[model samples]
Target: MSPNNDKETPILPWDHFSNWVHAICVVTFDLELGQAMEMIYPADRELTERERTNICYLAFPDSNSGLMGNVQFHFRIRQCPQSMNAHTRPAIHTYNSNCPTSIQIEDGYLYGYVYFRQVKDRTLRRGYFQKSVVLLSQLPLVSLFTAVLELVAPEYFETGEASLEAACHHLDQWPPPTPATTLNLPLLGTLIQVRIPSRQDKPGASSLTPPSPTHTMSGPPSVLIPTPHETEAFRVLAPVLPHLNLLWELVITAEPLVVMALSPTTAANTVQTLVSLIAPLRFSGDYRPFFTIHDSEFREYTTRTSAPPNVILGVTNPFFAKTLQHWPHIIRIGDNNTGSPSTQKHKLKKASALKTVEQKPGVYTKYRPHLQADKGLVKRLLKGVQTGRPVEVQSALLRRHLLELTQSFMIPLERYVASLMPLQKNISPYKAIPSLRPFNPDEFLGTLEQHGPHLTSGIRGDWEGLYRRFFRSINFSAWFNARYQEVSDKLAELHLQAVCDADLGGWVCSRSEVEVVDMVLRLRSKLPRAASLPPSHPARDKLTQHLHTLFMALPEDLRAVLHAS
Candidate 1:
């Protein structure tokens, strides 16, 4: 079916017209100023006159009937005087008669207005005025017309250069407006509106006024825009410099000269390869290489031995080698022996077995010192081997083994000491000496009896001798005197009630003169004397005995006051 041929072209909706304007503005701004559409519009709102003018100028800087012409036309339309008889009915004029429709004079000038009469209806029409009136009635078309005028004569709006190329070149210098920059344009709009002159005067005076070219919109306060130099600086410094310094440090430092392997097969092959490479350099004594099959033995060796300040090589199971890598001095040999799946499984089982053996409580106890002594000898041997002088590495190894065998005859005292350390705190001076009572020998004996099974015969005998010496060396008299003096000072500072509350089990006795004197005073102060009872009564004697103990702890000089009471 054919479409309706008689229908007029549908007028574009207002929203659609606004959208088209916005899209054009976006492309124009992006090309000229390197900014996106959102950076300018940000939200759906009416564009301010200045914003519209700027957009127009940016879009069609060279057009003659662009933004400036539209603005001028609108200004002229608004400034035109109101017609005197505009509210009255239209006057009819016949074509046969030659007559003027209206006449007026202004500013000493006379003017006549004529209307063309249509013969069919004898209706009069002012063609130019009516056309303008019709144009004004269609608001959407008016907006479009202004937009077209803005494109056609943009130079008429712009105050500066008419050359589009020059304007484009100047726009190229501006950075793309970020979201932060767009947010502040409203404030700039408000300031520009305030500065604009009123509409009553000639529009040309304001038309020539241009916005400041160098004025910059301060971006949103919270938004930070990094400069190109800062961005480049972070890029160069963030990832690259630390790695460069690390590489430099590694290259400059001397380490990992000697390699030790734990597996016999791997160690022998590694050492042989190293010897083949190092023996040809005729600079050193025989390099005493160290290797061990046991992981526990290797750990013990490393723990007791300190290597010289030179690079060293170490080879071990994959897991142990990972730990050695953390040490800056050791250079590890990688395992290159490829085996079948079954063989690899066997290797894993063997490594697990070695780890289990190393973790066993008895293994550490039995082998720790032997490993310690061996490691010390190996260190000395390695130091000597580093010199140019010839030395027997095998002989030193033999001596280390022989020394270990000899030392086995003597029992290890370290286990005995470790067992005794916890017990030592219980019997320490601060804990044992603070009591007012005399020291008990039973506690020490009980501790010895409990820990004696863990010690060797030699250590047990030595411990017994030390225990006896500790007891004999303690001066009980001095301890008692010190306690007595401390109590006396405390009593001298305290009141009679405090003295009555004190514990005086060890130092207090009825026969002591100081005790009797101090107690009598305190008892007399706290308890009133009965009129009928003598001081020697049973009740008085009991109170006097208690007071004596309290009084004995007072200072000797202060005891004189009790004696007087």
Candidate 2:
């Protein structure tokens, strides 16, 4: 439709009609260094350079008028190596008549948009590259397949193919999509496989808490924490932090209680993850405070032998209630109103009046499975939640309930991905599975042309990709909120212990905060199109400045001194 492309008339009805339209919009790129673009689209066979140019010409007839809104792709291309030949250069070439143009070629992968519109002006110049020439010389198979596929399944192949063809043609845009983002956090569960001190020796080494020379050996607090009537009715288990040559972390008066207050799921996950990592430890005997509270006079009537500080235990409703009264700032563990004064009184009364009953006849039983993949178990868990007799139990029962809920939600996610690529069962079907290696620019374009329809539909969730994985969706706020709650609770507990000091009596300053630094670093490494981002872009400049400031803010002795302190 462009003045340049107007010379060519469609040989076939398919060519005359708008089979597919693609809009290539590049919002952010660092042309000089090259970058990778993050794109979400379907996959298919390739197209020729002429075909690609034709697609782009028709898709974006006017440089002034952009493509459709929905069809957007984000990716980066590697910077083209110096002394670049035509093969190494970008496939798409444009001579914009308006602005000063700079040529930056990445590994020839272009990041932009592809729009499939109904009608548009056909007045644009055919781009530099020709689909026929590229197909014949560079990508024969892809071009051939695309042609065949277009004939066989025009509806199935054109749209995604057109977009990819446009992307391939525009490879000269200066960044190749390859690298991805990584938000680094400590590998949580991966730690179990790591080298660690023996669990048994850890307790002994940790138990060697030197007696305070400056402080007096005070007896346990006189205030009697309400004793549970049915102590033997339920067994409780809690996770002890991994011993890294440090004293046993005290969660009670150790830190402020405000930190543990997070959503139920988050708090539960934090407790579970922590529990999974460390050996189980229990708390027995009277629920008594470690430090004695005096009321003006030193005389105490209800003193008792305090338990060793090393043991870790779950705070039951009663224990949770008593602890809150003593340590007013104790972080609430779960989303349930356990800490809310109004809610606490009710739960306390509920805890005091408890009973264990036999299972009802003809009732279906559901047990949580060890792995999330068990479909049978998921069905049973859902059934039980829907209809089951309630049992008054310990934290383990609560955990089991939550586990069942989590597994039920996750199983469907895995099954959905599996349906996408039945041939490739190893990877999740829902995600945009990457090829093992970056495809050649020409060949990659060809592949897109062949399979573009499916890819675009897939990304839109119009087809299989929608059913793929929850993780694939760009909507991450819900998931992030869930995760954030979990991390916050666990971190709150860790932080409390980190700030506790024997001399200062809970005013101990936090010595180490490398976790935050490491998190930021990981996020930096995962930045898309980092290499291609220009020095002028606000995002690029902010990242650079933040990193600089981060490094400068650290004192020479910071790492060493913090750990030691």
Candidate 3:
């Protein structure tokens, strides 16, 4: 037979074909005379062997070929037992037959007789095609095989139905094959060779002639049977085949967008949810929903260091957000520090302070000028009351004037009082204190006389402490000045950095444009209003000009956004 015999033969309909295009079988062999012998010959074995033995059958319908009949095939392998010695391994052998089997549909079932001629010296070898055959057992196409079997031999079905509807119902329960299985097929056309007789042979030479039962051909040997391990694996994965197929479809078509959950468990649950949700849609066409929580597995699918992510869900770790930012397509959810309580508190405090600054304009200017004036008045009033006999004037007038002054500058005086107050045990500094009521001159003098010098000393000490605390607490000017200075310094630093970046070729140089723009925007936000700054302030003018220049120098698209804002 010619080596190209299989390729040269015209493809034939299933019923007309002498041999199968694809086939698989389960065979048992034992070692004899340093060779493996076929314990179960193809046709010599009873038909019951088809059911009792572990076998998988697959047949593809060629819609274009107009062949209603299915092509029946079998898998065969032969191997010698290995030697006990660690270094010594036995050689494997495959036997091919020259006499092709003729399969016929009888009683809605296919029956075939195959004869084999054992190739003694030919070593068993595997190529891409042979390996693919073994892999087919694990694929969704295995369902197709079972479906075809049920169609051909419905009586053989465990369900005891011999109708096409019954066969299709059985197929519905079978798991769909994995994408991998459907995708990989060996050079199937080359699996079997057909011989065509020349014109000199006979008048009907064009017709294929069945091989004599006695004749056996020698050809390449291969192991077609799946191992026990492979059978178990397929069985284990069969239930999930439908889900795998759904996910595969989603991935291939880029539907619903790829959402990578940071956790493996999350990913698994997400996949399950997505499969169920999209199952009803039943969108046609091939799609692969590929997802992996393992970083290594993700890397296997991506060619770049930064992969575009459609959506990033449940990324609680700020570190993950930082890493994911490198991906150009990542949809930013929010601040990375959003989950941090301390960060939130800091932002809240900053926001409150900013709001206060905006609402209470010139807070420092309003309070600073009166500090010295208020201090002098408080000292004079206290000194005058303590030293004067004050027999004619009532204490009520002095008390009312003191109350008015304290209330007039309540905020500043409160700050002063808080600063001077000693840290008292079991007392919170933030606690509120009640205001003192007015007292008449007679009432005050009578209490003073009754308590004598000790009362006088105590009252003087209390008054001094109150005065000190009130004075210290009224320094809002200093606080406001410090806050403004800090903000100013930060703005200056940002402006300097922006200038340095621009000098070094702007965003094109080391720094990312996005990061640079973020910095610029932050600095711009911190910039005080031109009206707030003194007319001739050099810093204000410099900042304004610097910001305008930076904004103008930005890319047209970014500049447009900024200008629009």
Candidate 4:
């Protein structure tokens, strides 16, 4: 037989025409018509009867797609069994402004379900068409991988005996189209032209073949950083950022319709999956990264001579406030504080000049304002009798650092007080005793016990001596003002003013202070039991346990109280 032809025939694109289309089948369960309406047509404001009835399906389109290709697969709306109203036949109706869109039944869980279908048809004019489920694991990756899959792989998902397992069986046998081929004419030509020296050649020639591509990792090597930005996946996901709210809307609408008990964990997991899908797209490190934003304008400020005078940029963003609330994480001056005479104040005045002012990429300022808040709280309560305003207190990690700074401050104050005590001991009383009005420690004690839970609780056991020394040595007002400076100045001032008023026997205390004191006292009483109680407590062992639970239960507005004091 003649030598078999080794040359391969090049594949023509026209010979193999393949079209892929995705179809979505939405299966809503236990959802009534009214419940579905609310889910599909949620609005910031309540809609009237006519408006509610005419509710439109507001769906967002896929952001990343080829110009000519179909991006979003399909949209479907359908009804399913109502677990809540299985006994009673239900009627869906539009409710009045006060009433929300809901199922007519007494109880149930509603599901706004979605089914995905990806269809691939090859143009095989002569052959019979065949379809079969194909195992995804068996297929070589044709599309980019997702982090979500890495986090919770298909194997980890518990597709049960009848549900997801059966659905997955269908996924495993999908008849896969042949792999598309790509050619590089230039590369082929280069390969052919490359001459190899034979082993028979004299001198240093050796017989060696180039390494095959199969031996090495196929893609170009890259350094993978944990930074969410700078990834190709992030770029693809970014466009869907605005539509992130859609998931939340879907849940809220489905909530009233379904009577089944959807565990909070289940709901939260679903929401998180949705968040993971959307967050990757909006992973812009330069701007807002989370739901809340830090908003503050940076102004140029004077600096020390050792350090070049710098433009002070004041940040008023709530995020910064939250960061400061963290205890020991002192914000410090950026190391890149070099300022040239050419790039000075007048340059900042110019439009172009503003861009030239350099900021140290990672430097931060010290905790000036934060320190003041800690010292001032006591003084303010004592003097002004003014309550602390609504403030977010950083706890756990934040508390750890803050407690450190407070302890450091108390040490110096205590030393000074000790020195003063020795001086008093040295000085003898005069033979003729000067009549003086008696001072009552009770007045101070009552104020502290009632208003300052941090002081009271922290003073328990041996810590009282440490606390007393600091109080004895310093002018609490001056210390408060100095530590906080302009940073935590407002809170410090409030606390100091309160203290001054209380000391002078003035009726300056406000109802707000009384309320704050009551809150602290109650919280203190509850804290120990919550900490000590076993997980199996029949009734919650402490009120503090309810704080987080209550927070999760309330509307977002009321939930804000957790962050605010």
lDDT of 4: 0.23
lDDT of each: 0.28, 0.25, 0.28, 0.23
User: Which scores better on lDDT, 2 or 3?
Assistant: 3
Error of 4 at 541 (Å): 31
- lDDT of each residue in 1-565, candidate 2, tens digit only: 0013232544432121111211222211223422222221222223343333332332221212232322211111111334122332121121111111111112222221222222232542322211211111111111122222222222222443454444333322322111111111111111001111122232212221222444223532121111110111111111111110011111211212111222212222232232221122211111111111111111221122331232222222222233323232222233333211121221111111222211111101121112223234334433443464232223334334333433333344223323332243323311222223221334422333344333322211121221222223222233334334444444433322222211221211232347434523532453443434455655555545544444444565764553363
**Residues 49-78, candidate 4, lDDT per residue (tens digit)?**
422221122111111211121111111111
Q: Residue 192, candidate 2: how far off, in angstroms?
A: 66
Alpha carbon deviation, residue 564, candidate 4 (Å): 47
Which of 1 and 2 is the better model by TM-score?
2
Error of 3 at 553 (Å): 5.7
Candidate 2 lDDT trough over 10 residues, lowest sum: 185-194
TM-score of 2: 0.16
Off by over 4 Å in 1: 1-415, 418-503, 510-552, 555-565
Put down candidate 3 lDDT per residue, 402-483, tens digits, no spaces. Answer: 2343333233323333433333332321122222222233343333334333331211223332323322321223333333
